[model samples]
Target: MRQFFVFARKEFYHIFRDRRTLLILFGMPIVQVIIFGFAITNEIKNADIAVLDQSKDHYSARLIQKLTAGSYFRIDRNLQTPKTIEAAFREGRIKMAVVIPPRFGQDFFHLRKAQVQLLADAGDPNTATTLVNYARAIIGNYQQELNGPAALPLTINTTVRMQYNPALKSVFLFVPGVMTLILLLVSAMMTSITIAREKELGTMEILLVSPLPPHLIVMGKVVPYIVLSFINALVILAMGVWIFGMPVKGSVVLLLAECVLFVLTSLGLGILISTVTDKQQTAMMASMMGLLMPTVLLSGFIFPVESMPKPLQWLSNIMPAKWFIIILKDIMLKGSGLREVWPQTLLLTGMTIFFIVLSIRKFKIRLS
Candidate 1:
């Protein structure tokens, strides 16, 4: 027991004494959370738009006012002809152009319907789509205001209730992803690099030949990282809740427990990586290629897995971060319980066991 404690203490000291390790262990999470929270967002704001209001009527002007009143858009140019609308988009001056035909107010008053064309740049499809949607929603709202009590006879009212995230804030979506990313990188990449570094420095052989058991030595090295990873998880959660208005809908204890599970899984993966590689640079490149890319791209973090092809979707199922992110969203947003997340939990447990066992076997072979 005393040897174990001493080994763990030594590992902690080694980590703290290294400036680069200290920076990654503490600094990376803070920067990632802040960047994801504030910068990387789906919400469109202050988007430049051009208007081709041939009507120049009160109704058209009011609709334009309503569109520009919110943070979504700003009218950068007023187009006189249809030719200029394309020119505005081509010049990179605007993302969308709203064209209201002449007699728009008269048509709305007499014919009860009017035509408005929304021309989007389509250079960036997602942004263009979002801009068009925002414009349509504003126009729809204006129409509703104009047609008060005597609702249009055949108009079907489809009330969309956005559950969990009513504001549609991208922060809610990003928080879980950022948490998964940070934990995976810190626990897996850093641990692998640290272990590989020891091997490279010939310190691992000295530790192995000591009185301490091999498993104990490995455990001691990993324990400090576990503690650090957990602290990072708490920091991210705190920032999500207090700074970004992210809700903890379920039990905080359950959330933390799940985070610990993910940390252990990542640590096991790191151990496996270290067992395979003899150099820190090799381990780092492996970790970045093996873990970071998949976590960012295929884990349903930035893109939807359902939208992916069948083979890619199957590939994503193996990504541990995918399951962790799902568990996070379920618990943090949906207020789900153990029963709801048991399948994902089981998968994570299986992965952790597989990684740990593989790493042990590989380490024994290397020792032999």
Candidate 2:
């Protein structure tokens, strides 16, 4: 512990001495968050949707079959009742829900009009909007086929409802994503670069020659960064909530705890990077190329993973940012608790342990 503090203090002094490093440490996340908050768009494909058919009539079944046949929506749930839509949305199961009222066949034939309700999860507003439009277009085509060459009195009205983010604010999506990207780059990139810099300066050998164990030496080096990254997380969270109107619908403590866990995971990844490279430039390159592109592309930060090819979708499972972003959205937007996010939480914990153990073995091999 005494040795840990000494090394930690040394790192603090080293960090403060480098002006440019300090700027990146604290300045970058804010700029990125603000920038990404306003930036948005994409096509929705194979989005999971739900169908609640109270009418259970021929018209309703035909409409559902028409909807299921299209490429835009996949029927994720054939709900028995309207009551389940909220739970489905909260569980992140279905993106949209179609409710067909009872007596659909009667209403269309006798009353000459029918109504269907569309409940879309607007967590990603563009997705919700696009899905609703797709469903409507399919419904329109069906209506045209039914009424072709003659003016029919029969009509179908769609009542649309947007859940979660009703106003479709892009900030809701970007804040969580930017938080994941920044935490990853800051913790992993900086840790790897700093360790590699020590190796480049030949100071790592002096530290290794000390009475302290190598693991503790490495731990001490990362502890300060863990603190700094955690602070960076909090700062970004504050900016997200206070500046961008982002809400912490779940427990704030749980959210912060997650941030710390992700920071440690990122730090472990950084340590792993440092073990493979001996130069700051090499470490920076690895962190940027290896971490940045994957986190941005594969993590569902920019593009929906479901929209990617099968190989890429399967490959994204290995990207830690992919899981972290899901956890963040669950906690921040869905108001989910440990019971809700436990699977992702467990995956992240496993990843943290994996990176640490693998880095340790590699470090031992290098030392020997």
Number of the predicted model whose lDDT against the real structure is largest: 1
Best by TM-score: 1
Clashes of each: 0, 0
lDDT (CA) per prediction: 0.90, 0.86
Worst 10 residues of 1 by lDDT: 359-368
Report the lDDT of model 1 for residue 304: 96
Steric clash count of candidate 1: 0
Q: Summarize candidate 2's per-residue lDDT along 156-233 as a digit string, tens digits.
A: 767887777775676788788889999999899999986678788877778777887767777887888999999999
User: On residues 1-368, what C-alpha lDDT tens digit does candidate 1 reach at each position?
Assistant: 99899989998998889999989988988998998789879999999999999999898999999999999999998999988876788899898899999999999999978999999988899999999999899998899899877765697777899999998989999999988998998889888986688888877778778888667766787899999999988999999999999998998999999999999999999988988898999998999788888899999999999999999999999999999999999999999999999999999999998988787777742443
C-alpha lDDT of residue 154 in model 1: 94
Per-candidate TM equals 0.95, 0.70
> Can you tell me which runs of candidate 1 are displaced by over 4 Å?
364-368
lDDT of 2 at 202: 79
